[model samples]
Target: MNYWLIKSEPSTYSWDDLVKLGSDHWDGVRNFKARNNIKAMKVGDLCLFYHSVNEKSIVGIAKVVKEYYKDPTTDDHRWYVMDVEPVRKLKRPITLAEVKAEPRLNDMQLVKYSRLSVQSVKEDEFGIILEMSEQ
Candidate 1:
């Protein structure tokens, strides 16, 4: 399965919010690239739930429950969304500082395209981040 990282402002939609809701549509992505990334997601793909802005950390894991479909939040046909459910909270959040410092994660899209809300993650990078969170 393909791995991904999806960012949200904790104040707007925290990890706790997702856990409480059970499963919800991941929408409101306006960026073309990010929207494409969302479209690329398939059911059962794993995603890292990241708190962007102030927190700037990956706080939990989520799994795609449904593939892309027309975004109910908007009338624009170009927009799309998917369903995701919280898998589990990490043992500890892996901060941006920690991610940037790790040489192995140097090539990550999280480092390369810091502003991208939805980004692809290499399998090895996904494994490394999970390892870091445990430590």
Candidate 2:
């Protein structure tokens, strides 16, 4: 299965907010690249739940429950969303600093495209992040 990273501002929608709802459609993606990433998602794909802005850390793991569909919150047909549910909160959040320090993650999109809200993660990068979280 493909691995991904989805970011949200805690003030807007925190990891706790998703956990409380059980599952929710990830919406409000305005960028074309981010939108495509959402569209590419499939049911069962895993995502890293990241707290962007101030936190700048991956706080939990999530799984895609449903594939892309018309965004209900918008009338624009170009926009889409996918349903995701919290898999589990990480024992420790992996901070941006930690990821930057790791040479293995140097080529990760999260490092190169820091502003991208939705990103594709290589399997090795995904595994490394999980390992860092375990520490």
Candidate 3:
């Protein structure tokens, strides 16, 4: 399955909020690249639920439960969203600082595209991040 990193500002929509809701449509993407990443998602794909803004860390895991559909929050037909449900919270959040310090993660999109709200994660990168969380 494909892996992704999905960011949300804790104040607006934290990992806790997602855990509480059980499942929610991931929407509000405005950038074309980020939109395309959303469109690429498939059912059973895993996503690292990142808390951006003040808390720049991956706090939880989420699974794609549904494929792309027209974004319900907007009237624009160009945008789409997918349903995701919380899988589990990380043993410990993996901070941006930690990721940047690791040489293996230097080429990661999270390091290269800091401003991206949604980004692809290579399987190795995904495994590395998961390992980091355990420590």
Candidate 4:
């Protein structure tokens, strides 16, 4: 079970939007690296839902419900998307400031590739973030 972090701007699509919809296709990823990350996802993989830009925090958990498929929003075949469902809202959001200050999360892709919309997370990093969110 690979762990991942996916970002969305709060104004465009927030964690609450996902929870209300129940589940939805994760689309609009234009970066080659991010698209590849989406393609790499498998059903049942867990993902952290992050609100980028202003909020800059991980607000909830989600699970992949479907594997990669053609991105319906785009005409290009190179892009792809996957379906994800909200697992639960975190007891407390893990902010970027908090993440940056934590030595355990120093090596996280979320910190290394700040602009990446979809990024992989190490198991230990995922565990640490989960533990932090509960506090």
lDDT of 3 by residue, 1-135 (tens): 999999999999888898999999999999899999999999999999999989899999999999999999999999999999999999999999999999999999999999999899999999999999998
The global Cα lDDT (0 to 1) of model 3 is 0.95
Error of 1 at 110 (Å): 0.5
Residue range 1-135, candidate 4, lDDT tens digits: 999999999999999999999999999999999999999999999999999999999999999999999999989999999999999999999999999999999999999999999999999999999999878
| Structural similarity to truth (TM-score) of each candidate | 0.98, 0.98, 0.98, 0.99
Model 2 lowest lDDT segment of ten:
126-135
Which candidate ranks first by lDDT, i.e. highest?
Answer: 4
lDDT of each: 0.96, 0.96, 0.95, 0.96
TM-score of 2: 0.98
Give the runs in model 4 whose Cα sits over 4 Å from its true position.
none
After best superposition, candidate 4 residue 5: deviation in angstroms? 0.2
lDDT of 1 by residue, 1-135 (tens): 999999999999999999999999998899999999999999999999999999999999999999999999999999999999999999999999999999999999999999999899999999999999888
Model 3, residue 33: distance off in Å is 0.3
Predicted candidate 2 versus true structure: per-residue lDDT over 71-99, tens digit per residue: 89999999999999999999999999999
